[model samples]
Target: MDDRLSGYPDPDFSLGTLARMGSSRLVTKAHSLLVTDARVWPAPDERLGDTVSILIVDGVIEQIGAGLQAPDDVPRLSAEGRVVTAGFWNCHVHFTGREWSSAATAPAESLQHALDDMLLSHGFTTVLDLSSNPRTTFALMRRIATGELRGPEILTAATGLTPWRGMPFYVKADVPWVLRWLMPAPATSIGARLTVAAQIRGGAKLTKLFTGSYVRPDQVKPMRLPVARAAVAAAHRRGSRVFAHPSNRPGTEVAVEAGVDALAHVPDETEGTETLLRQAAERGIRLVPTLHMFASTVTTDDGYLAPIRAALGGFIRAGGRVLFGTDVGYMADRETRGEYEAMRASGMSTADILRSLTTEPAEFLGRADTGSVAVGNRGDLTVLQTRDDPSPADLANIQATIRAGRAIFLRDSPSKHTADAP
Candidate 1:
């Protein structure tokens, strides 16, 4: 029997009907309408366009020419003086059923629902879930896919694949042990393949491998590499990509040689030379950078954060692609909104930052249809009420977050209008 239904009640609410009702916000005559008088960040490499009218229809854009007009029945939002861009994607995020570790032991369905609420409320309409037990994450994702729940489109990896010592030691043994219970008995040696199969079978879009160890207080250098070429090759055969969490030179070199697809975070403790950057570029591997997480983990010393920023700048200059990844909700001890602020403090330009949070991740995920505003794209978007212009602070304000054309999150919006569960 499927253990998934071992403990359940006839659900009090029909998620399908609720989701449909929530979607009605998008079912307007404005479906085929024009959004005029707004500053449009239309595409990568294009500066902000002058006040323009974007014609949208059936959740896709029909026209973006100047001076477009709205149809008679179509509702015309006074987009005047608002900054409009594509919906944001957090390439490196972890979604789970519990809050701040202190809350729950076993995964809770309500926890999943609440997380979906928070994510949509925060304007993250798409996320690549890098943390969580595969079963729990996918169970929630399947609901969203079936239109039974309103949440971001989810792309997930298996659980965090780390060697015994490299794994997070802080979590009580119960966490890893529960995951271990669900894993195969022959998993020790061939665990990567098993892990990959579990996630792929569960509909994961990618895989995560921890090829490095946590920073040890006494040790001068912390190094480890878990998954190897054979395992990565297996994932490739399964038509999925692997992202390696490599925080040291040896670990990074090994992951690159093994042909992993992305680096979850650039090593913050060490400065990467041009040689390594070139190798990564040649491999066509993208970097998530995840400067926010790095900054939070390490106390600032002279030049500690400097190299991170410089390395990112150099990578972009060297024609390397970058996707914005916040690594949010893994340990939500701190507020997640500060991620955007941290990036700005690191000297990233506003346009580049927005691209990382929006277009680039969409392209990386192969979900080009929902990321940008254009003809035939999904009507997922964000509207920011900026003060002066687009500043990092304004970006974090999150005036309104739209998922599938419905306002799931809005600053000062009515209580019932918001999706945040708490």
Candidate 2:
């Protein structure tokens, strides 16, 4: 849609608020971008020379060199020698916020603001929605895919399956009991299989299981091992990865025995966790240490925080893959700085953290093309404002979040930046 047609009077809509429309609605039309004078870390383990320029054409990296020439018409962004790397990915998130209820038909401006505030502004180019309403999630996906909205690439699991008679107390308190009772919690393997099959058929590319749900803060209900196995089998048969919410040791046991791909949380309970989690690591099961979620929502006391952080450090020691996620929509606080700090306390270095946000997620999703700044990779990149040559402890200091060569979220105004004229 043209600016006049959309009723937006801003002349720099493409270069400013909304992402530039590509020739093809599906492809972001090469938000045709060029970045000059930037230090680069192609990947966490691989570092490239400083002061390099990357040329992107048609949403793909065409070249990376200390000097690169481009057509005068292509838009150029001066990184001012900031640090550039592969785009960041948040492996867990939710689109269940009430604001997203209108995702399908919400005004672009309104929705864009909410998106920027929650995810993009913090440097997310891609995200995985663990569980959300299919109606809202699919609608959001369609609009973003068609170039109607500027947002991150979304992978959704739709509604998640819970154990029979199991619904988290927190979730139950949010709505009327009658409506909450309608939520799915399968008792038998057959019921679990059908739900998994139907959700995937409904366009949920991923599957989530509340293998353990908090009946009360201190009490839990574990999904039947057989039912969990059925759900995992059904999802894997369809080529979808399954994420599990192991609220405690029992839940972790169900997730492990049932063969879920990843543990969505660190199993909020500590007893018997270290041994089981190490076992999980040995099985090639990945973990998303939403440690910050625990710190913020639960207790910040050492008794609670120490054991949780220790579990994460132990998992990493046991070679468990760590994928970055904040449980953002589920928790009201969206800032990522605390998560990084907590991860560091868990003994992860700068490189370890970066890998979790980038390479690890790309590898986890079996997406070979992304999570690195290579010439042939997708033109998705995150630029961070660094005072020195590519070293930043807290990744929250984002200068710009670019997806497929388009600047979806620019922390600073483009006009004020020094760049070559188009």
Winning model by TM-score? 2
lDDT of the structure predicted as candidate 2 = 0.81
Q: Report clashes for each candidate as comma-separated counts.
A: 0, 1
User: Candidate 2, 415: how far from true, in Å?
Assistant: 3.7
**Alpha-carbon shift of residue 276 in model 1 (angstroms):** 2.1
Q: Candidate 2 residues 1-422, lDDT tens each?
A: 22111111112222111122211233334567888887888898975556899998878899999789999877788778888889999988987676675565778888788788999888999999997655556667677776777789888887788889898787766545545544668889999998888777666778999999998887999999999999999999999999999988999999999999999999878789889999999999999999999988887888988988998888989999999999998888888888988988898887888999999999999998899999989989988877464333548788888888877777866543333121
| Candidate 1 local lDDT, 1-422, one digit each (tens) | 12222111112222232233232132222234445566776665666666777666655666776778766754444454677777777787765424412112334555444654557556677778775544445455555554445567667774656654454443223343433333222224366666566556545568777665453532222223344565577778888778877776766777788788888887664645556766787768888888767667565553687787777666677777777887775535334456676677656677777888888777766776876777678766766676245776566655655555544455564433323221
Best by lDDT: 2
Task: Count steric clashes of candidate 1.
Answer: 0
